[model samples]
Target chain A: MAILDPTTAPRRSQLNQRHVSSHALFKELGSNLVVSHYGDNDSIIEEHSQAQTLAICDLSTLPRIGFKGAGAPSWVEAQKLNLPAMANTTVLQGSGSLVAKLSDQEILVLSDIFAQSKDVFHLSEQAKIYHKNYDKQVYSLPRDDSHCWLAVSGTLASEMFSKICGVDLRTHKFSHSHIAQTSVAKTNAVVIRNDLGSTPVFYVLSDISGVEFLWDCLLDAMQEYGGYAVGVSALQRLTKEH
Target chain B: MKLLTCPLNGKRNISEFTYGGEYHAMPDHLTSSPRDWAEHVFFHDNVAGIVTEWWCHTASSFWFLAERNTITDEVIRTFKADEIYQQRVEFTAVASETQS
Candidate 1:
C-alpha cells in the first residue's frame, strides 16, 4: 500500500498523538531534552540524551544526489577530501565517515547529514568553480532538509519503532543502506536503520506537522519501556560532550 | 533543512530556497489586475497534497518552479521559471479543470 495515500493504504493506527514526559530534555538527570525528535541515528542522537532514562535522535542534515556517467568517479573523488572506493567496491576508502559523496556526482550520493570539516570545503570549492564558469551553475546544500527526524533509542528503541512502523526492526537484516519507505501513524516516511553496536537507531523522515503524531505513537508503543520525550535545545546540551 | 536539486546543477538543501508556492500556473494576467499581483505575493491557498511552488535559489540567484507534495516533502516535478511560465497559462487551465 502507498504510505502517502491513506485511502490507498489501510489504516491500522491513528494519525495524531503525543507521548507523555515527566521531565524536559534539559531537566533530566544528565544533559537531555524532551520535546521533539529530529531524525538521526544514535551516533547523531547521543548529542542530546545522557542518562539511561533519556533517548535522543540524530539531527544531522545531509545532502543527496542522483548521478551516473564516466565522469562519476572523478566527480566523487573531486568532491570528497578522501576519495570514496570505486563505484562498485564493497569497501569505503575514506577515513572520515563525516563526509559522504554517496555515489559519483552523477549517481545518487546521499551525503552525510552533519556538516563536518570536509562538507564546508566542498561547498566553497563548488562555489568557486561556479563563479569561474558562470555558464555552468553548481548546486550545493548548506543545510540538510527540514525533515522531522525522529529516533527511538534505548533498549526499547527497536520495539518503539516497530510500534510506529510495521516493518521489522531486526538488527542483522536491516543494516545501513537498508531503507524502507513505509508509514508511521498514517504519515509517509523513509525509515533507515543505523547500527550503533549495542543499541540500534531508527531514522524516521517525515513532515514537521506529523511530528507530534509520530512522536505520540512512538511514545505509546514505548510506554512499557518508560520512555521520555526531549526537545532540540536539550539535544544540544546532550551532545556537547561529543 | 530542505534539500533541493536544480536540473542544471545537482543536489542542494532547501536553505538555499524561498518556497514561492505551486509553480507552472499563471495569474491570469490578461484578466488580472495589480491587485491580483499583490495577492499572488501576499496571499496563499494551501493544499494538503501535491503542489507546485516557485523556489528562488537564493545562493545561486536562479528561480525554478518545483512540483512538491506538501505532506511527503517529495518533489513531483521542477522546471525553469522563465521557460515554463510561457506555457503555464495553458497548464493552469488544465489544472483548474482537473480540480473541478
Candidate 2:
C-alpha cells in the first residue's frame, strides 16, 4: 500500500499535517535505531552514531528544533537527560540507554517512562526561561514530509555507503558530532555519525516521493550483508528468527 | 567556528567547550566587600594581557583553569579543575602565609 506521499502536492500550510505517533514511528523504523519525538517539533531525526550502523526514519514528516550554547545541556537537563548533553565532539553510548532524563545541572539519568511523557511542552518552557541567564538558543521547526530510518552495520557498510552515497568517510576529515545534508543516490539524506566513536550513522531522510527510490538504494547497498528489507513485524521477531 | 587557542593545546575548535562567562562573575551574595564586590561584579578591565578564566572542557569532561589572553584569544596555560585553586585552608592560615 502507498503511504502518505506529500512531496508531489507541496501544500502551502503543510506543517499542520498529521503527526506520526511515537509507537508507529519507532515500530516502523525497526530495532536498529531507537526512535522518539522531541517537543512539538517532530521533524528532528537524531540518533546515536554507534558502530557502522545506519538509522533511517520518516522524520521529515514531523517537526524539529535546535538548541545551542553552553547552557544547552543545563536547559535540556532541566526537563530530561534522555539526550545527554555531551560535548559536540562526543556521541551517546551504544545500547547502554538511549532514553534519558535531565535531573540537575550536570546530570542526565536514564528514565524508563520519560519517552511517552506528554509534559515536554511544560518542561521546555521552564528550561527556556532558565536558559535566559546563560547563552542558549533553541530553534523549533516542523517538517513538511515523512521520514524513514535505516541502520546498517558491519565493516563493509561504510564502503557500501560511500558507493551508494557520495560522502567522504575518510576518518581524519569527518568524525562524530558532524552533520551534512547530502545526496544518497538521487534522494536526500542527512548522513551523520554511524559510530558512537568515529564510525558514522547514515541517516537517510527523504520525502515520501523518494521512498521507493531510497528503498531500492538501500537494498542495493545492503545486498552484500544478506540484508533483506524487513517490516516492523520482522524487526520485532528478529530474536525469534535468530 | 570561533577559534580559541589554548596556550597549552595550541589551536583547536571552539565546539569542544562550555563558556564560563566573564573573567569573574562570582556571586555577590557569597562575598561582602562593597568595594571588592563592586570591582569583581561590575568593573571589568577587559585587558589585553593574560587573564585567568574558567573553561569547562565538555569533550574531555574536565574543567580547565586556563591563562587566556582575552585580546588575542590565546590560552597560555591550562590546568585541571582541581589545580586551579589551592586546597581549602583556614582564613587565618591564608592571612599568615600572605604576611610571611
lDDT (C-alpha, whole model) for all candidates: 0.46, 0.41
TM-score for each of the candidates:
0.41, 0.35
Clashes of each: 35, 37
Q: Which stretches of candidate 2 lie over 4 Å from their true place?
A: A1-74, A77-90, A93-137, A143-147, A170-180, A194-201, A206-209, A231-242, B1-100
Off by over 4 Å in 1: A1-77, A81-117, A124-145, A230-242, B1-100
Please compute and give the TM-score of the first chain of candidate 1 against the native first chain.
Answer: 0.51
TM-score of chain B of each: 0.64, 0.52
What lDDT tens digits, residue by residue, belong to model 1 across residues A67-115? 3333444554566544434321112224323223332232333333332
Candidate 1 per-residue lDDT, tens place, B7-100, comes to 5334554554567665434477557788987777677778888887878754333567787888988998777665654422332332335553
Question: In lDDT terms, how accurate is model 1?
Answer: 0.46
Per-residue C-alpha lDDT of model 2 across residues B1-100, encoded as one tens digit per residue: 6655432333445664576644663544445667887877667777778887777644223456677887777767666544544432223322334554
